[model samples]
Target: MYLIPGFLKPSTSFVPFSEKTRSMAARTNKDNKDASGKSDGRPGLGQLAEQHLEDMDACIQNSGLAPDTLAQLKLWQEQQEQTLKAWAKRPGREHTSDADRFGESLQDWERAKATFMAQAAEHPKEDSTARDFFSHSSAKRVNTDTVMAKSLKQQYPNLELVITPARTCNLIAYAQAGLASFETIGESSGKNPESLSWDLYVAPARRLDGAQGGIAERPFFEKYLYKWRGLEFIIYLVDGRDGSQNYPSVINYYILTPTKDKAQLLILEVGRWGADMHGEILVFDGGYWQKSGELFNSIMKASWDDVILEPTMKQAVIDDHLTFFTSRETYTRLKVPWKRGIIYHGPPGNGKTISIKATMHMLYNLKPAVPTLYVRSLSSFSGPEYSTQQIFAKAREFAPCYLVFEDLDSLVTDSVRSYFLNEVDGLKNNDGVFMVGSTNHLDRLDPGISKRPSRFDRKYYFPDPNLKERILYCRYWQSKLSDNKDIEFPNELCNAIAATTDDFSFAYIQEAFVAALLSIAQKSKKPGKSDEAGWTEDLGDGWVGILGGGDADGDLEKLVLWAEIKKQIAILREGMEEKQKVQM
Candidate 1:
């Protein structure tokens, strides 16, 4: 019933009891009670055993374990101590063999662990479970994940097993998106039979369905036998958290299906649909290809009619894109590589961006829908060279794709100039890639990229708007405010505003119109309906705002639009001239 102090040593390896145990065995404490159930002042056997284990702290700590496993072992040791106390109730009566058996059990604990370790070594998984999946983690949780997967495969020989890190291919999320279906088989929900617990919680449901309630619950770690496409498969997912952030904590998926093809088909479809996010455009940023539906929606507003370029130049830009994409045969027949690049050079805000957007919209309307790849920046975790390589690789993949390089002057800096040109001009064929780069200052571009027709085959200049275009812009603003009834914008005011806004870009004119409208809106006293002559309505998307009716010689200073726009145009002109001086 009693064991001496210092019985165990500082290592978990088995060893005989120390001299302290035998010396104590040869004597008995004078305070020790006899088997007649007599009381003594000595501490109970359970208390002594607890103290012994505490004294063997180094031994237990050397076998470092998970908190959960250590807690379980502690509880088991406490229960063993209680059993020894029960035997001590009948001191020296019998059951000395139970004490020996308890020591042997400690050895058995390590023996079983050793066996599991030996088997675990004969497997895959980088020596542990795939715990950490992101940049934030690198730790591995000691568990039976690898062993369990191997055992399951052996147990189900007929079923083909395909294991994947959940991050690489998430089957559960695939089923959740309605891209595929995984119905539970009879009497089984997806919980692994061996698992005793699960991690599940409720999060925002509006993210999944707009009309649904605010919250919905989903399981975190679970397994089930599911029937997908008439094929039975076992899907298991588990969370392997390593207790801290800086460790390898990842979720793993184990799929056991009737055949490898069935598992592969499901995986392929999930990967395809996941990468090709619906209603989203692929834009390069932060060194990766991100899907942006917002960017796609913004480009949808770009119509060629919104661009105030002359018909010939507008049609030239249109044909440059249309003929290239549709005339793959023409390039082949002409013995030239189908790949081509175009540069849209201009003063700021004269329509370089809108033209590019219009081209993107035009491509989207074609049969089978050509995708567009937009590049915003070259800054990334990897260097800019890596960014350039990935950009071209993706462009090649999505060929017949419009690859836009907005603000090319700033993007292709001296540090990456050579590398950037290599990707664009190297031996690799970039056929079907209608690459376009826009820059406000064409002089800033390198001659290798700017002057060479082999690179950018054509350059389209988007200069400041001419007088006729400015007149049409003002009349369009007049039509927009015709119903306001506060600002009287007569036909003469359009001509007067256009006459004064020389050397101004369309952006400056738009700013003038907006400033004038805002000034009118802020006035407390609204202008009454005009006694001035109004022109016939010419409401169309085209540049037909020069409708004739009101006299060109009529007074324009009295008109509200004319008055407000004059001040705005003066302010804008001053700012533009200052900018020009600084540039010089």
Candidate 2:
């Protein structure tokens, strides 16, 4: 006897068929039959007959019969199979593998074919009365509006309707898309290659009213479908939740199409919408326009307090400009253009870029929210005139917005100087638009663009930080490091560091602090390092005096052990000196 693999063997015990078991099975089979002689929602007589044939074949294989008898049985089985196959080949009947019975002869097939041919010959013309379901006629187009109306009538028979301003729609769309839960996907676009990113957020069906414990359900909008421009769109409004907030909503629009070409067209339309509504920055690259995803975290967090600028300069550039914009009616009453321009000119490594970020953050938090349009470059465009027109057109669309032109000298080259100036001061009224431009070299800009009135009217100089400002910057670092309980930074050390870094800019001071902290952290990790003595004799008299008396407890030298600070400060000073030499 052959044995089955242990893993493949069935788990349940098998009982051999006997007279009693056979009788029970017959009774169960009888109970399953209906009065109409059909299957009582179970396996029918055809399945039972097939199972019986399989059982008979198995019994015949196990039994050792005479050769003549076996041969006769095999011949009968082969003839039955051939007859079934031949019957299945006949036209007008669906052929299936499960088909077994056959009664029709070859003459029957010939007679049926002859009859079909005769009928076709008698009426050979196409029928004009019959409608073609697959016809490509324009009249077959489905009306999307009618479908939506009928669906609404059946789903929400008594729904109320409300009319409001178009501006209200913008607010609702913004709230649903901006404030809802979202995921971002980044991509690159244009021949010159610029980054483009968009957000996908769900739209909810139920909208919560301001009243206590009230929810306005929109059951009909759960999976709303509509047609636009001969293509079907299915919109899903789903219920969602934000952090620590309940009952937020998300709306998603999907194109309903089986063809790839139609699906791609729908995606292009959706992408255009995403570019318009969600983008925070507009960049012109490779003769085209692109939108950036969001402001960088570092830039978003920048503020006046973070930068090292004089209080008076901050008040003039940031505070006064914001105040002037709020006085729009005052400007109008005086009959002056409701526009302003400011330019920031300074050497590299100064506070120009950080100040711009701070101003952007300040303006974004205003009462009505002033959006900022950042232009990266205009070098790749066919002509600056067309590019400038497109830029101003978009700026006007988002009026009361801030237009930032970074490295203005590089963008408004000699070729595009006149075109750029015209766009800046042309007949087009740039009301409610505030422009800010920054450049390292003031001499590179054209006189008409930089020195002219009504265009970049105010110019601010960002000089390197003086000694007093340097001391404050050092103290700022000290305050930050005070939070770390393991580190001890004395006030005298900050003052000494400030005095030593006299010619350093704010950027250089920041670098020094970073280097010094890194040195301390590196030294802390090494093993077999015992508490060392304070400043040694090799540090020279100047270093010793700056650090104060050697034995004085809690002094600069005793707190950090001056050698570490001295090493990092020397390295930073050497690097700065080398940079200055290169510039010279």
Candidate 3:
């Protein structure tokens, strides 16, 4: 039998029981206070207290507490009960009945004994010691069913929570609770209720080639995946880093339009945007996608560009992406009943890809806490030469995900374009897959792909960032510089650079700064130069090769620095432009 120190005494000299037990006991006595309410029922309460004291004495004689502890206990109980009754009555509600409170305490004590006996029976004595040590302190036993349900409730508040085999809990149960509750609203409250859902982990993508395939199912998986309604949206992030090359992290999103015949997965070629590396992936459900495209196109074609269109066009791009996403009314008005395709056409380095990312943030409301999936390339999936429909059907199994295709036009050729046309115009148009494609040579795009009305009715042209865009670009770069502040790009100098940069993309602007800085460093390193801050203003100007900077003479003076700057800018721009010209 398990023993509580001393339950039979009302002493003024002992260490007391726990705050929880004393409070509960006080409330029980308060409930029994007679009409006079002057500790009228002390005798009855004392009888109950005495019974507890005897039980503790019996157990202590066996081992836990000493005989002197009995006197200490009696003194402590009398002192604590007086304060507890007053505290209980202060609340003004009828006090908790003595029977209910004591019954619960007894149940707790009995349950602890039962668990101790069970563990001792199953394990050897030495192994049981740890369980006994913890149990002795009065911690509640872990009731598997209750614990599991409570955990599920806390993780997924929106879903109708139900668990079979109540005692079972695992990562799978945790994941399904999220998936089933994806479309739900409201928070959950109750014991072991769910908490916020941050991410959903699916079974790892597997390949069936050469004796390496098997079926896997967890409890919640069996319950949720097959029953998902609406479109299966998926986005993927592909890490593109190689030791030799540096590339920004890229993520792509796609939605699968399911059909009985086959599934077609459409890729959004424009990239999404975030303030930082830890930003959330935005999902433009079909509705958000269509509306955003319409509003964006209308603004581009209208005077909004003239009023807000600064040279580099950076603000316009950010604005267009944000405008559509921030307003739900706009989303509802522009969203189509069926999914529509979007095409992003622009020059290299003008953020054709980044625009897609920003659009996603807007679509998903840029809420950082939500979990999203990003698939960088379609090639990652290996299956039978499946139709587009099949790929999407498989993707939805990983739903609440984004399916992104970096560059789609290149993937679809004249011949393949026809196949793609058939899939989109085919029976699978309503699956939840969102499609987007980006291209540099819009004119060269196969007319068969472009001419279709709703196939890709929205075409966003990302021209080189104009003057205002140039300023914003400078600001963006400045914030990325030593301090997180926008440095003023000298207007005359900026205008000259903007005008001279006929078709320069944002990438080229970055290169220009790098070249200028390198020129300064190289000049300062020249054999005779004592100035460590690099070249003087005159030399810096001469190195950049602006007009009236004594061209031939200065060029001769700083030949090596000039050459290095020119080479650095040209090589970087040329390489990036050429690579971006190709479709992903």
After the best TM-score superposition of candidate 1, give how far the Cα of residue 412 lies from its true spot, in angstroms: 0.9
Please give me the total number of clashing residue pairs in predicted model 1: 13
Q: How close to the true structure is residue 105 of candidate 3, measured as C-alpha lDDT?
A: 51
lDDT of 3 by residue, 229-348 (tens): 343321111111222334332111111122312112111111111111123332233211111333233222222221213444545545543443345455458675334456778766
TM-score (C-alpha) between model 2 and the true structure:
0.52
Q: Write the per-residue lDDT of candidate 2 for residues 148-229, one digit (tens) a residue.
A: 3343233223332111122112222432454322221111221211111234443543344333333343321223233435
Model 3, runs deviating above 4 Å: 1-338, 366-375, 384-404, 413-423, 429-434, 441-446, 465-489, 518-584
TM-score of each: 0.65, 0.52, 0.37
What is candidate 1's lDDT per residue for 1-584, written digit by digit as tens?
21111111112233223444433433323234546757455543334444455444433355443222233344444555455545555545243444446556556655645543443343211112112221113334455355546654544445577877676577767777775566432111111122324345545534634553344334434555545566667776666454656446576767877678888887777677676647778999888898888778767766786678877999999998888889999889999989889999988878888788888888898886889999999999789999999999999988889999999999999999999998888888898888999999899999999998868899999988898888877766666555544456677778788899999987788777666655755663634323122322222211122222232344676666678888999999999889889989
RMSD of each: 15.7, 20.7, 17.9
Candidate 1 TM-score, true structure as reference: 0.65
Identify the leading candidate in terms of lDDT.
Answer: 1
- Write the number of the candidate with greater lDDT, choosing between 1 and 2: 1
